[model samples]
Target: MGRIALAELSKYLLDGHLSRRGCLGARRVVTRPVAAGWMLPRAGPVRAFHAAPGSTTTATASQGPAVPLRKQLKDKAKQAKKQGKKKSKADSQTVDGWELTVGIEIHAQLNTSRKLFSSATTSFNEEPNSHVALFDVAMPGSQPLLQQETLLPAIRAALSLNCDIQRVSRFDRKHYFWWDQPSGYQITQYYEPFAKNGHITLYARDGISPEDGESVTVGIKQVQLEQDTAKTLVQTGNTHWLDFNRVGVPLIEIITDPDIHHPRTAAVFVRKMQLLLNTVDTCVSGMETGGLRADVNVSVRKTDDPVRKLGTRTEIKNLSTIKAVEDAIIAERGRQIRELETGGVIVGETRGWTLGSKETRRLRGKEGEVDYRYMPDPDIAPLVIGDDLVKHLQNSLAVLPDAELDRLISEFGLTPKDALSLITLDNGARVQYFYRVLDSIHEQVQAEFAASTPPDLKSYSTLVGNWIIHELGRVTTYKAGPLASGELSFTADGECAQVSGSDLSQLLYHLYRKHITGKVAKELLLAAYLDELEGGVLEAIETNDLWFKEISPEEYSVLADKAMAGEEKVLQEFADYIKFPQGKLMYLVGKMMRLGPTERIDPAAAENVMRARVEGIRAP
Candidate 1:
């Protein structure tokens, strides 16, 4: 009876879906395939999720709703910087000798210009049901035509995660009744998924983490392609509204084994997955907008039980953010333990992470595989890939985050902490910016040195990295919006800035050749990033009289003599050998630095000369 009613509704939609009386809109929606399925949007005003159909509203994309998830994150970061991570309720907490275990199933919408089975378009903020096609409406006899373009990201994800791709894969029908699902059934891979048996290791670079080292490898059970359902908007008086725009969109579901032993570790694993997927252009950053989400499976077991049997697990569905995942697991772990201690058995059920109360609310009893009535998708045929296609995908895949972390540390001579910072920020935009500047410098040096005397690029690594990371990044770019969108249109200083690698290279080139002091280099870098310098760093140096004058060894010795004469008390302290500190040496160097052209002196060389002079002093 349910199947008959769903078929009738499909036929009803197919009759005159976009006519004058259609539920979507009065006019047809025109979508250019080139402009379909939003890319990583630049930070601006974006309407995240909609409310009841009437009162229209919007929000700042970086900051979510009233509480503003990103703001909370920024505040947490500040607290962490000062106080360090305090033990939270979720930090490897055990109750009566019981341990918690969690696994995750992530469904990330693939970044594509069109739907998985039809030419219909996909988008973030399109009108309701406007992007719908015949297949999306689930009209009877509408054969599923596989969109070859949709498979690219799926293949890329599997290969990047080290999954074994199945050349021959088939689809299955997952039957369920929901107001949002127009077809009453979803087409997904189940019997033989496209990929399986992979692992993503967390903290792969820095073992400084006291958590699992390489042992924190989250085993990926399978990767399967599936179709997304429609969006249902709830209104006042229990009114329900359906939007078919998301119907039939393609998604690749990655399932992980129950290997995660800590809540924080699970959170890190999800965040790492988001970075990796976004880096490969899978477009999974839409946690707020439903472009990406996860369902976590949580269970607890007695540590002292010799058998070490697993407890009954409950599913926490639809966690959209990293914090939510960690918090939900922590809450559920406590809940399960409490229920068992009170002489109550843990029941298998589907639960929701309530945002308002910050607890997991029981939604319904868990549905078994038999309840879903899984069957072969008769309309869709087995998906097969040629050997050539698989080989090409592997060769052309984007470099994963872990691999890039290793490369930066080994090839570029960056510290592990610095390397991880670069790759994680702005979805690797800092890393990209770093390389762009490096390329400019390398090109500049190639012609200066012969092939036999190829300049040691590694020698300049520290200098280049310091200017980029410290001056340009921390001072300006990161302040623009560190935790939010990395590609902030305007910098924090309210300057519409676009500083190129060549501009930085020019500034560093002068600093490298000792034509400018480090202080002057920093000023140039700051000016360039903010676009305050009109004619670039070179012209600014020329116009502002910022060039450094080389102080001869004899000149340094004279400056040291002046430094000692002015700092009588500090010199006395140095003479007494009591309270003789490194700062006293720097204090004398600072005196000399201010005497002559401050911008022209290298304080380092002056410090060396001043140290020698101070060594010859006596208490008398």
Candidate 2:
């Protein structure tokens, strides 16, 4: 007997001449069948054993049963097919007993006129390369100069997130090689970020009662100020062009702890953050335009794990929208679970989500701290914050979302849901418009109160909120340009309605006073779209022929006689209740309303006129 190669044994096993159990020298060789093929033990070379022709005995001293070649091949192929079928099933990837953990990183571009480290303009959607400055392009002699305006927004954002703002911070250069980065590095806060150890409380989705809704508090790890890189436009093939207009733009990266367990929770948190940032005028928070983006890190551990050690995490980068963030997290979690189930190790890497494919693809291996080689920049000095400056920044901060929401609820008497809805409207200008309308209404109410006629603030606030959130908000296709120009316009679905806050206030005032019907007010609103209310709601109503004429008792007598002509039952009913108008008030009002000058006439006034006419007709 000579030394036998494993390949030769595998060939013999495939050919049905050798059994799985065979003896070789001092060790016994065993081969187990696998899905793809066969599994063999790792050992040294072994002596060969030859089988007798048409016999189940080996040529050596050992004897074993032989399997037919065709049968063995068929069985192996069938097993492989079964394995493939199992892999194709989604149940094979089920991690029903695993606990999922997620963390998010949000990069929100600050709303500033100038770049973070340069005087270059930070306006978006501008002509390519036109807004780029010498410093933005990283010229040899150009040095970084920190923008003071950038700090205001960052500090406001930190306060909104309830984070601790550091009095002193320094800029560090994060070295990385990328064509989109002209400086070959990014200036960011590494050693000490501006804010840290904050938390955001997010409630469940809409329609869930506050008592029943569970609130999740996600911890904020840190909020750091950094400069944005230039935009990279990918062309045909491997060609990529860079636009430096966005280079050096200010950004605040908000990192969160691994407290998120559900996808919807992450979405709610992102939306809340966006609203808070937009409310403070920190960032536009537009995902489509790249004003805000998210990076989600997901990992899973066995639900039964006693030690509770976390599994490997995969970072999904640059999720541009809240929905994208949710989708990417769910898909990545499933991928990791499936890989683990298949006896495959989950790799720690940076992956990109292809929204079209709805799958995560590997971008690159994860980078460690040493990869960045962070160090304080020599050109820029450390930032020193005095108490006076901090107080100034704090005083300069506008009413944040939470404070405003509370005010709207407590002072204005708006419901919690209504207040939340008003503040979280997608357009920040709309939210501003809501407050302006509320203030104008308040002023009017105060004046009326001074005149000894106080109005219900709660009812008025509810009416205004409903009008803005439901009626005005429903004009989705309307032009939003006028809002940016300090006016509101609704020009879509064949309706063009544009009016300023004052014009709308006047219309609401007339309606509240019962001077005009809701129909007339709506018509006036539509008329205000094309022209400003020159003489206020009255002029608009008169111009549009929406005014209602008040009929006197003598005039209503003539009209009511005509309306009751040949209708003896209606006339008798009116005559029967002539002295007590309350009995037939509704009937008489309906008859008089038909004969009124316009539909905008007050129904109560019509009823009164009808009662006076009926009484005069039935006088003893």
Candidate 3:
């Protein structure tokens, strides 16, 4: 009885004769004048009932349109199934029944003149092991001494991340047997680290959709000072050697909480941190040269679990690039999910990311705290970071990336995207070069407009940014090739060997004032880059005779008259366009340009003069 009434109600709804609310609330429903149905509210469930066929009230099939009830139900079911399939496909990339969590550990080498425990020079690409001191090799009777110069960069890094600096931090010995560490232990801040409880805010890069402009804060577990180990070099076959030159180099390890979920977030966090460290001049932030590296911790867990407890994690060590970090996490997360699906447990272990295969392979079983015996180092004294020192470091802190980005936008009138591109450039020297050129341009303009309306700085900044980033940046790529191939060696200090910021500034000023055309500017830049410009930009323009000459309107009128005198064909062309007022004037201007010699003439002034001459002749 309930099925029959429900069937009748579906038919009414399909025919557009029943409102949803009325159908649900009506105690009795009548499809026809004489037919009746009733809804029964039971203890367990509410049911619908239809009147018997032979009862007092009944309806014939002719009362409504001839539509089959079975077909209606089947169609509704099919539509629902299609919608469900679409939603499921959209979510298919997500780990089935699981969520991902990631944490990162970054090791940034400190920029210092000497090593942390020795006076050996901290230089790269030097003769192998030549920079190693006696103490670096753990010589007998040699003791570890802290480098005071390393403290400022560390303090600045901590403050930049908004970490709480501990006034007194102690060093500890982390004991382990390894070929790289001759001393069989490392000196690091374990029990009392320098800073804790810090965080960095990140934004998605341009391509991402949902979180493109969104902010995500990743927590900093700790930032501690430690010594770097020697690099192990594997020779042919099984023989390996160690280079002690890198040993004892100062390092700051920033450990992050398990706050990252998406692989892109992990990559973005690393990039932001790298930019911050570079801005502070703490490190070069070159992953390829081993100046910075990251260890990523990835895990997965049930998605719907309320507790959101983390599953057992696997650590992928020494991921050297941002792409490597992101790819490693994504690959590891998928691996763990697949393992769980196959009734395999995720083992707690350490792994290495193979760049060639883009997979994580087991390195060793993960070590617990007990595996590495930790104790306070009796030789080195505890570091006491007084308020005076913290205050001094804070004052010395450079403008960080985010703050500089904001300043570039607000003070210089640059768009957010352009400002970010300038500040986050890989080479710090290029960023410095941009500002230097910008300042030079502003100074020249200011001097020129001492007592007049100031030049539009917004326009100047945009112009400078475009030329520097797009033009100069493109021309400077030759240095990346072999120097023996005749490529100019562009120094990392932002100084081009053949051209300087002052020279570029002079050229830009000319371009801004319309003293030179864009084609002439490019020619001058290329000439300057190739060291062909002997006495600088002015001399180059004079020597090449590429300067643009601005003509007075009266002078341009005389020139136009001389060109139209004996040229009959040109006269006929001008007379043919006399019906259109300005056409003849435009023709005269083109003739003037074609007749001009040596230097390029100002087209605007010539156009005005030609129009005045044509109007005077037609006035009578």
135-234 per-residue lDDT for model 3 (tens digits): 8999999998888889988898999999999999999999999999989999999889999999988764321214324777789999999999998888
Identify the superior model by lDDT, candidate 2 or candidate 3.
3
Error of 2 at 432 (Å): 2.8
Per-residue lDDT of model 1, residues 1-620, tens digit only: 12335554453333211222334333333321111122212223222223343444432234322333345466768878655444443344445578888899999999998888888988777777788899888888777888989998998888888899998999999999988787898889988899999988887453312556554678999999999998898999999998888888899999999988777788778877888888777864557667789999999988887687888899999998877988898899988988888999999999999764557999999998899999998888899977788899889878888888878878888887788777666556767777777777777677667566875777676577666666665545454444323342332222224567678887777777688888777767656655577888888888888888787898887777877785688777778886567887887888898875556677778887888888878646
After superposition on all CA atoms, what RMSD does each candidate show versus the true structure?
A: 19.3, 19.4, 18.0
Query: Taking the candidates one at a time, how many backbone clashes does each contain?
Result: 0, 1, 0
Off by over 4 Å in 2: 1-96, 133-135, 204-212, 413-417, 446-453, 474-497, 532-535, 542-620
* Residue 401's lDDT in candidate 3: 81
Best prediction by lDDT:
3
Candidate 3 overall lDDT versus native: 0.77
Give the TM-scores of the predictions, in the order they appear: 0.77, 0.68, 0.71
lDDT of 2 by residue, 1-620 (tens): 55667876676565433433434434543332222233221222222333234333123212233444567677889989998898634332334688778899999999888899888887767788889888888889998888888888888888788887787888899999999888899999888887889998776433222332567788999999999998998899899888889899999999999987766677667877888888778986578778999999989888887688889998999988877876787788888888988999988999999775667999999986799999999999888656676677677877777677778779777787887887766445556677677788789889878968676787787777777776554333353334324434432211124567777777777777666777777656655654656687767677766655555666766766665566667556655563564655566678657766766457766666666666665536
State residue 254's C-alpha deviation in candidate 1, in Å.
0.2
Error of 1 at 569 (Å): 8.3
Between prediction 1 and prediction 3, which has the larger TM-score? 1
Cα lDDT, all candidates: 0.75, 0.73, 0.77
